[model samples]
Target: MNQESNNDQASAMNTEQVSDQSLSRRLKLALGLSLFAVMAVILLWLSSIKNIQNLEHDLAIKLDTFNEKNMQSLALAKNADTRSAEIAARAEILEEKYTESFDQQAALKALYQELANNREERMLSDVEQLLVIANQQLQLAGNIKPALLALQAADTRLQGFDSQKAVQLRKSINQDIQRLQNLPLADLTSISLKLGNLSQRVDQLALVSDRHPNSAQNKIAPDTSNNPWRKLTQEIWQDIKGMIRIERIDRPELPLLTQEQTFFLRENIKLHLLTARIALLRHDEVTYKSDLAAAQSAISLHFDGRESLTQNTLLEIKALTSNHISTELPDIEQSLRLLNLYKLSFVPALAREPKSKRLP
Candidate 1:
């Protein structure tokens, strides 16, 4: 409605411009009005263009400022990334190098502690307990070279042990060790030698048990012999030594009983008979007595130690020989008692035995 009203007013104004008496006067007035309208249009269009240009200039300045600030932010981020990478690389290098040196020094400190006398002495009280632990561990799967090296290392470290144990260990254990390399079951070889000796010892000692008898009421007469217990103890000692040598090659099949052991066991009993005759001829019950006692202890040690030796057959012998000897046989009781100590060692042995599951 407003646009129509405006159009009507413009038409009326155009009519008035043309209204005149002379054609020349009217033409001049119409031309003046058209020129004025054109001028007004040109001025309005010019003002609009100027406003647009000013707006574009202000926007351009804002864009330039934004681009500059963005560039600075990007450069700072890159610098931070580079510094972080450098710090991380340095930290890794220090961890690899210095940490290794620190650990090496700590290891040296532990070694020094191992050699200290106070520390060494402290370990001895538990040494007997550790013997089985060591034996069990030694029994487990291990490389031969490493096992031998570890054993040698132990010997080297304990080289300065107390004189008493050192003497016995040297005189007995080391002697047995001399034959170790030749044996397949490295742990049992020393005990094998002891067993060999013990077979004869047992047979000979049996004679004493036969003569004196543990059931004897009193010393009725000399009987031209040592006490029965002494003889029995001696015999048991010798038998155990031989038994330790009794190992099976097939290992896991039944209880072990090697060829060497069978041969030693059979022949040794005969040798004991001869030894008894010799004792009778020499009138040297003391020699027999001493040897029998010593043999008992030595054999006991093997059974109780690394050989994982056992006394099953010996217990059978005791049952078999129970009626053969009387109750007065102190020597037999003593030997049996010592053997009993080692007998307990069988528990672990049988548990670990390739075949047997009886106690030690």
Candidate 2:
């Protein structure tokens, strides 16, 4: 009876464990299916959002690029106009100040001249003073037209002086000239022409401003502009540097010429160049050669046509090689001969002249 009860309990325990395992497997399958569905939905949503983001970013980039291009144009126009206004104002101020100064100086000079010459009593109603004032005003008036002309020229330079976008800038300049014609300034045609030039120049700068890569992000223009005198000075400097490199005048171990000799050569070259410059100015070759020969002698280089010095003296230098000097004191002995020769030559010449009467 005890053995049969133990077997029955063991079978019952095994049946319960099998049933629990079956339930647990079904629950795991259901949870896994739900998780797969949620993950699939999340992946699809992320894909759609990513495409939208890329497109939005692309649109923003393109818009910014377009705005950058437009901004370059705007900045060029605005800057050119602003600079032109500044130049005009400056020129006007300078002309006015210079004219006033000229007027005052002329007045004072006239007063001074009048007082110095004692013309105050000779002139009627101070006509001389009035005349001087008139002359000064006339001179100032003459210069006024030139000053405006210079401004107009600057304007022209501003208009057509495009470094870039020649076509568009020129068209824009034409429009600007048309607009300028409506202003109240005299010499409208000339002023308009100048404005046209300025607009063209702006267009040029804008065109050049576009060439640099990523100019939209970095809008700085190239420094291609040149100044007349400054450019000339640069060219001159470059030329000097090139010449220095070429000549190699300071080279060590230079054969056949010491430092002093080289210095003399350079000095002579400069002197010749100076002489040539003077000759060119005067157009006289004889004068040039004469100056050059003199300069050569100054450098210890002998020149042609040196006069032969003659010694007709009581004493003469006597060398044993050419004269009758047998002693070692030949120099002293020759000097004594020269002294005697000088006395003999002078005495006859002095005797021929009329003698002064003895003082009473």
Candidate 3:
């Protein structure tokens, strides 16, 4: 029994020993697992701290670059603001300058319009004055040439205009000129010149009463070379023939006049011609014809009909009597009336026209 109990007791002790070893091994495994877990946790925490420090350093570098860029951006923004202010000021100045230029242009336009109107008015006034002069020449003085010249000058003045009134005025003036040209007028200067020539030739004219034969040719001189008795006989015969003077007489009576009376007769004839010339210049037809007829009658009665000079003088006087000194003048009232009408109507029409329209 003691041996059996020892065996049982040894078996029980072995079982206890086995259970204690397994428990120790289990404790060691658990401690090793805890230590490994603690090391892994420390490694993970260290790695995470390193990663955090790297991230913080990189973030600080990025922040410095961002601050520098922000400063540059601020400077650029300031410059841009200054430029914007300058541009705004310049824009305001430009707007003011444009407005001033517009005002100046408007003023210039007004001055131009005023000058144009003044020029036109002055021209029209001058035309009116010229037309008045023409009318005076036609009505007061019977001078057709001066009136024609004045009318032509007025037409030349109107040539610058293109209006219908100007054309009508020109047409009227032309009609007046044509009528004046158609008139037959005497040349007073030529007739006066011819009469003056005839008056100067009064001394050369031969009178009928002054007719005489040459007596010196018939008188014989005593010839000294001939015999004295023959010369005495010739002288006696010449004296006898001289006492009985016989002349051929065609007229019944001859007028006996002294030298002073003959001079007075020529002076009277000159007075008649002078009166005729004066009457011609005065444009008196009745006085001119009567004086001319009286001068012709005096020349025919006093002057020798056989003298060429007397016949020519009478012919000239007869031709002068037929000359017309004056003619009927056409009235220039139509042109004057048209010019006045144009002056009255043109002003209102000009006023109605637009300011934008300009003269050529």
lDDT of 3 by residue, 1-360 (tens): 999999999998998898898899999999999999999999989988998898888888888888988998998999989999999999999999999989999999999988866766676787778778878776776666677788788878877777788789889988987887788867767887887887787777877666554467677875877588888898888878877767657756646768998888778777777887787666666777787788788777667766788888889989988988766667888888888877776477777677777465
**lDDT tens digits, residues 121-236, model 1?**
54342333333333333344322333344334444544566655444433333332343343443222333243354464453332211122222432233334668987676667
Global local distance difference test of model 2:
0.44
Alpha-carbon lDDT of model 1 = 0.46
By how many angstroms RMSD does model 1 differ from the true structure?
Answer: 28.5
TM-score of each: 0.23, 0.21, 0.52
- The parts of candidate 3 lying over 4 Å away from their true place are 1-122, 199-283, 304-309, 345-360
Q: What is the C-alpha lDDT of each candidate?
A: 0.46, 0.44, 0.79
Candidate 2 local lDDT, 116-201, one digit each (tens): 44432232123223323333322333222233333233234334323333233334434433433443333323432432332232
Ranking by TM-score: 3, 1, 2
Error of 1 at 178 (Å): 44
Global CA lDDT computed for model 3: 0.79
Which stretches of candidate 1 lie above 4 Å from their native place? 1-33, 87-360
List candidate 2 stretches off by more than 4 Å.
1-360
Clashes of each: 31, 28, 0
TM-score of 1: 0.23
